[model samples]
Target: MFIAGDGAGIGGAKAAALAGKIAALDIACDLDRLTAGDRNAAARPLRRRLVKERAARPFIDSAYPPYAAALAPQDATIVCRCEEVTAGDIRHMAGLGCLGPNQTKAFGRAGMGPCQGRYCGLTVTHLLSEANGLSPDQTGHYRIRPPIKPVTLAEIAAMAAPEAIEKSKRSNVSTQVNG
Candidate 1:
């Protein structure tokens, strides 16, 4: 491969042939009129801006004021029901003994609420994890069962035949057998 660039426009044939073998190509008409240092200095600001914007923002739960406030107040109206657990309550439970979401729920009644912790489960886990000194992953998310939102017996009756309803009940039971 050969590259010869002088006054006249860079020869396209030569450029195409050397393209693959070239490691870096700088095109500057009147190349000798400007020094390499001058070009590099001009690129500094662009390089700086790229570096500044490349950083990632922290996770929502990690930086939000509401999250910090929630952790500070236990009786704070826990937003989710499935997990009757509150940040403050979990903190209290952690002080007592249990250190995990499952244990905390079992003994403290946290995350066991009606909503089943769906809305507040993650928040509760985040708070409990911090309070109990557990990892976020260790808090383990809640088991989302069928009919995540409660359905009334009447609703089930209206939707299915008696046998179907009974089968649903059995299936629901089987679904949660290990849960």
Candidate 2:
């Protein structure tokens, strides 16, 4: 636990070099001692600190770069991976006078995928809004019709609950909708 840096009255390049070497050697010796120990320190139970729900966010957010330098899916990259539509494609639609997200969706087929509009809707809206100089609210996302499927009585019956079937039988709740 003894520090060897009595740097007082010691001046010039030679003393500076000696001091640096001594410091480096001291650090190296400490590292050797630590490594040579029983290594049982790691076997000790970890002291877990209780973190509040809101307190965790600052630690998580600090790991990211500053807002301006933060990374995001780039502009020409394929954003709607489901439909294989690039951000540039949606932007190009905007350039061609495509007004809103739905228009971009219709033109580029970006939001029409297995996940319906959920997957690509946000990316399409952001790109479309940015490209056309409109707000996100203005560039409205695609109108999602349910997970595109042929609705038949048999299909409905298979998926419907027993309670729903009995309730329907008791009342005229029309399950059919005009496709």
User: Could you say which candidate leads in lDDT?
Assistant: 2
Cα lDDT tens digits, model 1, 1-179, are 22333212223444333332221223431355446776456545544543343333234334654546554455656544554445567667767876666666676766566655656666767766877678879867666454456889989777768788799999999989967
For model 2, residues 76-136, the per-residue Cα lDDT tens digits are 6786777898877877888899887677667878777776666677777777777777887
lDDT of each: 0.57, 0.61
Candidate 2: stretches off by over 4 Å: 1-72, 151-179
Q: What lDDT is reached at residue 95 by model 1?
A: 77
The C-alpha stretches of model 1 lying farther than 4 A from their native spots are 1-67, 71-86, 148-179
What is model 1's C-alpha RMSD? 22.8
Separately for all candidates shown, the number of backbone clashes (residues 3 or more apart, or on different chains) is 15, 0
Top-TM-score candidate index = 2
Worst 10 residues of 1 by lDDT: 20-29
TM-scores for every candidate against the unseen true structure: 0.39, 0.44
Give the root-mean-square deviation of each candidate in angstroms.
Answer: 22.8, 23.7
